[model samples]
Target: MSYREERRADQVAERAQDREDMRLKLEAQLEAKKIAAEEKRKDSEAKAEQTRRDAEAKRRQEQADKRARQQEKERNKAARRAKYGKVTGWLNRNPVTAFVGFVMVCSIVPAVISQVGALADAGVFVLLAALLSAMLEGTAWALTFMGKKAEDEGRPAGKYRVATWVTAFLAAAVNYWHWSEALPNQTWVAVVFAASSLIAIYLWDMKTHGSHGKTTEERREEKARKQHLADRRKHHKDIAAEADRLLSALPFGSIDEEEAFATAWRIKMGAEPGLSAEVYANATNARVALGAAFELGEHVRPELVRAGMLATLYNPLPNRLSEGIPTLGPTLPIPALQRSSGAATALAGIGMYGSEAASGNARENASEKDGGSTGGNASGNSPRGRSDEELEALLPKALKVAAELVAEGNQISAAALAKRVGIRRDDARRLRDRVIAERKLKLVDGDDTELAG
Candidate 1:
């Protein structure tokens, strides 16, 4: 029994020793794995911290750079402001000039704003402004046409009466269109406004200035001066409109040399004021360099009649002059010019040429005459030259009579006064009769002959 028990006990002790060794190996392996995982986590956390710091530093640097740039811009702006102030101060020293400039700026800004609106239908306010300007301009043109006889004759042109009425009508129309979106309502308002304005202006100019019996000569002179000033405004308006039409036809980058020339030719063919020529030459340097190649021309006419510039167009014999080169000559046949991108280039050649361009002018004058004018057939054989002084003297009288006739309307009694005024006696009597009928003038019936106002 002792021998068997001893063997069993020894086996149990061996088994316990093997288990202890296995446990120690497992514990060592677990400790190594835990250390590796902790090292990896620390490395990842450190990398993240580094990234965050770099990002923060970069953002600070960006903010600093932005602040520096803003400072530089502000400094430049301050310098500009200082310079501008100096210039303004100098101009202000002269009150008259400063006032003129201010007035000009005020008028120009409004006109420019209106023009911008007209270019495209935009906000209601902008559209209204544009319509107002258009109406004023149109009215000026109409009045110009009506007052043509007086204006050309060099007398008082006419009052602002017509222009004001037209402006009122246009203003009303604009208010009705974009603001109210009602054409009929706007039109009716315009009609009423125009009528009222016309009546008021007529009263101011024709009636207000009139004396109970006879207006003072000084007052008449003042009225005439005002009328002439109004005419000057009308001329400027017409010129501006013509310039605008040309501008509309030639958009930037839209027209090549050929297209630009074609536009010029179309306008020239109409034979209206070639005011567009001056403006187009100033728009772009390229257009200026390509000058008369873009001008209007009909079938080649006699060179002698070209804008009275035929003599200048002719070539000079190089030997005849100091230069050996054959110079530009009048006898040279001016070829029908076609537009090109860079054929004969220079702004001097196209955009702006003073007396220098005379050499190239094929026909600047349009027509030439040795002795007579175009009215030879209709005016008979004798030709007369106008003496401006004579016209000046006669124009005033004619203007006065015409104005009276206009004011008299249908009721004027045309009689003896008509003859004195160099018009039909009947016309005068009609005018006199009209004044009395309208109660505009006082009239007393002298049982035998009626005395009239």
Candidate 2:
């Protein structure tokens, strides 16, 4: 009985053990499946992340490539511009050669295109025409250049200029004739083209070389010449102003005759008297008028001043007497002195005399009394009277008297000078003024006599 019971129990126990082993195997298989699915998901995520990184890198490389291409394009453009600039600069310097080359290219290329079948003949003809045009233009340019050069050198450019104009007209006519023959139906178009070409060449020439072909050296010289002229004009103006000032400063009163004579000499020698002949004449007239006024005991008149100036300029001495001084015996009457003086003749010439008939009668009477011609006493003096020779001859003596007056003292008046030199008061005043002006002396403000150099 014990063996049978033990066998049954053992069978049951074996069945239970088999059931538990199957459950554990199924659970392990399920757990392995879950882990495999998680690993597949992680691998997919990693691959996706790698693909995004690759795409981003590719996008960045493409942008860099685009920027590099743009930079390269800019560099190429700049290089081309620099090369073209150099070529243009060379062409500008050699305008004739450049124009010839341009003409040849334009003519030959067009002929080649239009006469493709007869290239050899058409090319030769086109080249010939271009050469002719270029030569004509060159001739004009040469003539202009030569003329400008001559003008700059101060030589006559008339011949060269005439040749240039003639040559230009002939060239233009020839071009028009050639265009008319080449494009008979489109003659107007050809004329316009030829004219435009000519104008272009002229404008180009003007741009490269000035119209006058003025070189840098010539321009500088012209500037210098203008400056020199301006300086000379200023100098002349200053001299004129100084002369006017001196004339205006003269006192309108009686001056000693000796002083007046001395002053005239000083003015002629040292006071730049002839800088203005008009001013000198005016001063002489004032002196003579002042003397006359003093002698007559009257104020100086405008008409008398003008008459005296004319007399001094035209006739400095009396016609009857060869010398300026009268013999010191008795004072001559005013009418007698006037009739004998050449000053009356000058006054007549200036239309200042009171009556033409009176002057004529006086001259006739003098001529009869002197037993000489109407003008002079068998001297070389003209009918108008004696020249300034007599006055000029007394210059030395007057100069000596002036030196003595200056040596005497700066505090001297016209009256004192007249008494000392034994001359008229008006003449003395004139002489004192002449000496002061010639020496560039400064006059004392209150004292009319005192002067300092």
The digit string of per-residue lDDT tens for model 1 on 1-453 reads 598798898888988988988899899899888998889998889999999999999999999999999999999999999999888888778655465446535543444343434334544476665665655645644564455556556666546446645554554444334333324555564344334323333333333234235458978998897886466446555444444466577676665533443455455544233334544334333322332333322223323224323333344643321121122121112321221222212111111111213322322222122112332222231234224454345444533443343233211113323443443332333333333232211111111111111
Which tens-of-lDDT digit does each residue in 132-226 have in candidate 2?
55566567768878877887798998898778767666655555655676778988955654454345435434543454567899999999988
How do all models score by TM-score? 0.20, 0.27
Per TM-score, the best of the predicted structures is: 2
Worst 10 residues of 2 by lDDT: 444-453
Q: lDDT of each prediction vs. the true structure? A: 0.42, 0.49
Residue 77 miss distance in model 1 (angstroms): 2.0
Best of the candidates, lDDT: 2
lDDT of 2: 0.49
Error of 1 at 112 (Å): 41
**Once all C-alphas are superposed, what RMSD does model 2 give against the true structure?**
23.6
Model 1 lDDT at residue 437: 30
